[model samples]
Target chain A: MLPLPVLEKAQTELVNYADSGMSVMELSHRSGLFTDIITGAEQLLRDLMNIPDNYKVLFVQGGASQQFAMVPLNLLSNSKKADYVNTGSWSKKAIKEAKKYGEVRVIASSEDKNFSYIPEVTSSMIDPEADYVHITTNNTIEGTAFQNIPDTGGVPLVADMSSNILSEEIDVSKFGLIYAGAQKNIGPAGLTVVIIREDLIGHAPESCPTMLDYKTHSESGSLYNTPPTYGIYMAKLVFEWLKELGGLKEMEKINRKKAELLYGFLGQSAMFQSPVQEDSRSIMNIPFVSPSAELDAAFVKEAKEAGLETLKGHRSVGGMRASIYNAMPVEGVEALVEFMKHFEEKHAQ
Target chain B: MLPLPVLEKAQTELVNYADSGMSVMELSHRSGLFTDIITGAEQLLRDLMNIPDNYKVLFVQGGASQQFAMVPLNLLSNSKKADYVNTGSWSKKAIKEAKKYGEVRVIASSEDKNFSYIPEVTSSMIDPEADYVHITTNNTIEGTAFQNIPDTGGVPLVADMSSNILSEEIDVSKFGLIYAGAQKNIGPAGLTVVIIREDLIGHAPESCPTMLDYKTHSESGSLYNTPPTYGIYMAKLVFEWLKELGGLKEMEKINRKKAELLYGFLGQSAMFQSPVQEDSRSIMNIPFVSPSAELDAAFVKEAKEAGLETLKGHRSVGGMRASIYNAMPVEGVEALVEFMKHFEEKHAQ
Candidate 1:
């Protein structure tokens, strides 16, 4: 759980957002209070990310899934084709959504390895005629993350950094667009944080809905439509929390420690096995399999009884996953590890 | 303010969503728990609206402003032209956004009358080649509302009912599409409620962004992108509340009484005047101007002192306005009327 003070402060305000004499749910997006929240959140985001003058950061709704289509809509104007690296479910979804709009070239993929690792893709492999190169920086479902950023030379590079955003520092100037859903490391699910190069705006096809036009949204300050108000408000709080915790560098240290402790325990455990390749482990999601599906079911049931919940893996994959997002304290992972050890000992007999 | 029970219940859950052991804000949209919320909300909405089997209701983000563009993108494909009735700010926005996609004809407009009344347009006035007829059922800022639905013959009729949705009963079969922002009579500011006819689906202009395509969102059950989980949850609660209130029929009766009481005071007051034409006065929003802008400011200041807030009008139209949504009880409006009476007498002396 998050700290009591932080949680309670947010809870109290959720019932009544900022002095509006209304719940955040009841406030109007066209109202001055909401516009302030939207603008303030955007400004604070720029400050926290140190986004340079040329990058347009949009506070869009519909998560990174929407960007799966939007990135191609805006970037694939001058060029008919784009290159994509399929890292996991999210990257695959990006590819699927992009195919509707343009010709997407698969530059690299880890599908042969069940997406347990990020494929190594070099800049030379990227087609020069391709409009942009798309990549999913972190694969939440498969528990794999890119340890290194891909080089796209002068080409526009788009990334879905949903799970691992703000958990580590990155050179924002390197990519053309970096989009993240705000549930894992940022704040919430509804808000999609998009940082796009200035030149990437205004290139949407005429058939693109006005709301999906990045240039229109950038010009209107993301208030072109009613954005998720409370989500943005909470994101602002999370940004403040990130800043107070010494930003991404400090977050990276803690995330690394948490991942190492959990992975170290899994490595030492005789009954438990991690599916992902050793070097490609994720810092956000940690998925592991037991000796059998029956054992996995029993393990999850016992873990839930022990207050370790939602450890079930995606339906496509049968295993257990522990998503230790930014909110999941190091102690939470320690508790999970301790629970796993006791469960393993009992099952070993 | 909403009743204490409603506020407290939401507050309790705002800190932690169901079963996830984390705030709804922290849950991933792809997670099962959040998906349940989205589907549950959609189901509740369908139940409350008695939505027919042939209609698809989408819980989209970005509110009705997004729909201003989407409606044209989807429906405008059938014809090179569309007819629009301009009543106020929202209708004006719809007309403006539609202009980007196709030729828009103003069948009738209240703008010449200062948008103080709803224009009376006949089906014969609608162009035979027009794709659809668009109208704003209620104007939030200008406080004008359509007392009757416009007839569009076979050419589809689309309505932007953002402020007045679920506030009254209407034949669902009458509209090709009805879209609403959730802040007023639905749930929150971020989530948009769109009920589109089945036959109207799959008409995207080829280059439309998937995020904004009604057909894509409908087919995917609004999960084409990550939805606003907590907002949808709140909307579910609101939908249940509407059901408990005996649906929109009962809501309309109570709403009528509330609006009459407030308007009664405005009509009798020597110090104030109604902004919109009285015949087309909105049951939801009542915008009235004092004898002077100074008097309007003073009225709002004194009204806030009496715990009657948000009575200040929009910046574009300088006056005092009161928005009496479904959540605002008739007693609240009565209290406002009493305060207005007291203020008028005090200022008259």
Candidate 2:
């Protein structure tokens, strides 16, 4: 969700950012304005996440899916074997890409439970020789999240936080790298935010393509080539807005309230059931299924009519999924909960 | 240059694009609306370029620079050798990347003339056994353009049209593949348009990164992952505007007029000189140096004060440059020509 304030700011400055007569789109990325934009976004994100000075934030393209490939390209070359925790479809996709580059071990998987829970990770499952242990912080389709980041011992932990980043407080030092596609919780699509420890870069074998090399982007400070200027500018605005809203601690407080509002309603609903296991349920994505497919269809249609849109679950796991990102206002979720109650009463068993 | 009409359309539809109640930025790339957007953009670009049925237009990210690496990673792995024609800085960059993947033969070069001219190419200059031949359709920094497409004699020819696509009419059927970063003639940065022949979609070497594989993008319709949604949407609008104003034939006519306006003035100027050879001069990027470096700096300063922006020439070759892309209006060139005349008269030694 692009917050209303973010939209207003972008709208007011669509033609020109700050005092520059050119739109952010027209500014040469080498220009000082753009340098400030990309750097400001990084600094804001760093402050918000409490990222360590050792980490470098690189703005890139090709989305999270590309990172699924890039992570392997840059990191896996150092240790061909990397431990992967398969929680959902995103995990499977990442593993498939990594296998092409090096050895990827599925150390633990919740696929047996239809990915409705996060699998328990133990030190035995982690290969000390492995370069990194990969995890999807939140599963958007299956409505699951890592309630606690697994202890990787000394192994570098990497995560795809595309679905839940910026919605809660996280220890930046806990993970060696964290990448998120910017469509959710951040700004727009097309921009991928990669926060990597400086030590992990430059290990890719000579066969790795230059663009996929983290070293290229890191050395140039994410300005190796022309970046998605407009997206980065929007992200900077979103970060500014996030900072103004009292950082992630405050963001988490509101997010938990909003998530609990809908989840609490689901807990009492007679006609709806959330598929996620209680301990691993995602606060960011709440997926529920009605007693009948016909009822679920009707509820989705009615919810759209009531201005609650994009409630349809991912096709891979069909039902209803409400993504309540940081930008989703409490009023929106409360309204959704109210609507769900009305629908439940009308179709109660 | 983002045309005022494009900006106006984007501004008016910034928050709710076509009554969807969501900004294009927030739209799910997999949603029907976004499908229409990405596909509509491809279709419009296909229409504009008269792309043949045998060709596929893939809207991938990472810009033309990424393509510089991707083209070699995917295509050159077959023969492990490719012929590259060096026209300017962009060509040199592409060759540098291609070398990392496989052997690149400099078939012909104009560096002897300080990249001020496009070298003539004959079929003999191409390595027929080479996987492909590479060229830059237009050099953005050095202000040189290939007035004629080289005859590769059945060798697949890949061209980077980042600075000149849509500004002119060309035979799309002639090249094996063409890619452009969207910042110039398309819409914005970060969106790379890759139009390739169906036959060249697959067959990357085993070591190729998944994201760098053209097949990954082509097979998924450039939707295998979240794409640069907003950039594609804006490109759609720009395409619509272009179609409304009579497509590429008309775009070419106006662009030629704009080019001639400035070039004609440069031709008559005594103190101002274009370093490019006449036959190889770029209609898109017009670079001219004054009699002295101080004079060139003064002109750029005065031009910016007069509302003309980003006229500084690339530092590799210091002077002043006016990038009059397809979005640049004839009046923009007229004003620049007028300013140059006034500056020349004032600084005449």
Candidate 3:
């Protein structure tokens, strides 16, 4: 679980934000209190990512789902064809939304393999004249992740790291744009964090709505319209918490340990089988299935009674999923492992 | 000075929303906790608006600013020109944003009269071929309001009622669409409420972003993306409070009394001058200026010492403004009157 101190501080301020005598939710967007929260949240985000001066960090609404449409609208300039590598549900959704705006070329997809592994995309698969290349760095639903980013050559590289952001270290300068919906590893869901290169602004088609325009939101400091104030505020706290824990390097080590422990238990157990290939298994979401769907339901039901909530996998893929996000304590995982072992043994017959 | 009960309730839940055991800001959009919130908020809005069976209410992210663009994208179908009556800052912004999508004809404007009154429009000024006629029922920044809605003559009439929504009574069926940002009267900013007639849906341009497409959001019950959960929750409370106060008709009577008291003071005071023409003055925002900007600033500074906050006029107009929203009690208006009378007596010379 997340630290008590951070949650307590957030709780204290939730009722009254930064001495404004109003909850963060009640503060007016144009008020000085909200200005501090917005500026502080942006600054903290920039610091967390060591974001360069050339890249702009925008805190927008609609999570990464909306960005699926915005990315093509803003970046698919000079060419109608954009390349997308679909690893899971989110990536596929992104590609689907992009189709409405432009021609989306699926350079690679793991759907044929039930999204168990990230497909290898060759340079030949990508159109040389494509406007940009998009990829999902982490497949939250499928429990897979990209071990290596594809080579886009000269095209701008865009990645959605919603499920694994702040859980590990990464080279921020490599991608032209990176967006994460703050739910699993960040703070919440409504506040979407977009790290876009400065030059990508103002390229939206003439018919693009003002709110969906990157240039408009970026120019207004993500306050062009009223932002999700409390979500950003909590995200700022999460960033501060990450910094206190020695940034992403420490986080990466802890995450590796947690994943290793949980995956080790799954691999050694004969009662369960993982959905994703071992090499491509996600460090955040671990989806596993039993010999039958009935057994999977039993596993999830027993786990919830044992205090492991939300263990049920997505309805599309009926199974069990253990989401060990940044807030999921190592002890919590250990407890989950102990429970999983007991449950497997009890149901072995 | 909104009521303290709802704020207190919201303050308590700000830390943990509806027994989800986490702050509303921390819940995932896909999580059941948030799904219930987003859905419940929409249902609450539908109930409050007494929305007809044919109308759809969408909970969108960006404030009315986004609707400015989306309205034209969705409703300006098969027509080259749209009619707009420029009543205040909001309608002007809507007209400006709409120009990018379609031709706009300003049927009437009060700018020549310093925006102190809503101009009387003649049917001759309206283009019958226009796809939709848009107006801002209440202008927050200018303290001007449409005393009477012009006849759209069977054409769709849309309104941006950002500042004055839920403060009075109106027949929802008369308009094709009504949108409001929740900050002023409804609750807070970030959550925009859009009520659209059924026929207005499904006309968005092919290039419109999914998030800005009214039909897309309407179909998903605003769960197409992660909506601002806390904002919607607080807005739900505000709607409940409105219902408790006996709905909009009762609210309109109380609102009229508050406006009359405040306007009566402004009309009689020798040391102050109101910007709006007497007949067209806003019941919500009352903007007044002293002999000079310096005097206005002093008046504001002194008024704040007496616990009268946010009385400074909007930056566009340099003076003093008292926003007596639905939440503002009659006692607060009396207190403001007392302070204004005291300031006038001391500074009249």
Per-residue alpha-carbon lDDT of model 3 for B1-349, expressed as tens digits?
3456777776577555676566665665677777776677667666666778899888877778888988898887887689999876777789889999999999889888778898987666778898999989999889988888777777888999888888887778888999998878877566788989999899877777777788888888777766776677777777778888888888899999999998888788898889888889899999999989899989999997888888999888879888989988888899999999999888877
TM-score attained by model 1: 0.92
What is the Cα root-mean-square deviation between model 3 and the actual structure? 2.2
The TM-scores, one per candidate, come to 0.92, 0.98, 0.95
- List model 3 lDDT by residue over A1-349, tens digit each: 3454567786677555666566776666788877887888788877777888999999887778788988998888888789999888899889989998788888888889989998997777888898889999988888998877777778888999998888888878878999998766777555788999998888988777778889988888887777877677778788888889898889889988999998998888898879788789889888888899888888888887776778889898889888888887899889988998888889888
**Candidate 2 DockQ, CA atoms:** 0.78
TM-score-based ranking? 2, 3, 1
Error of 1 at A112 (Å): 2.7
* Model 3 CA deviation exceeding 4 Å by range: A1-4, A122-125, B1-3, B15-20, B26-39, B122-124
The weakest ten consecutive residues by lDDT in model 3 chain A span A1-10
> After TM-score superposition, what is the CA distance of residue A67 in candidate 2 from its true location, in Å?
0.9
Which predicted model would earn the best lDDT?
A: 2
Determine the backbone clash count of candidate 1.
Answer: 0
Residues A181-287, candidate 2: write the lDDT tens digits.
99999999889999999999999887666788999999999988999999999999999999999999999999999999988888987888899999999989999
Clash pairs, candidate 1, are none
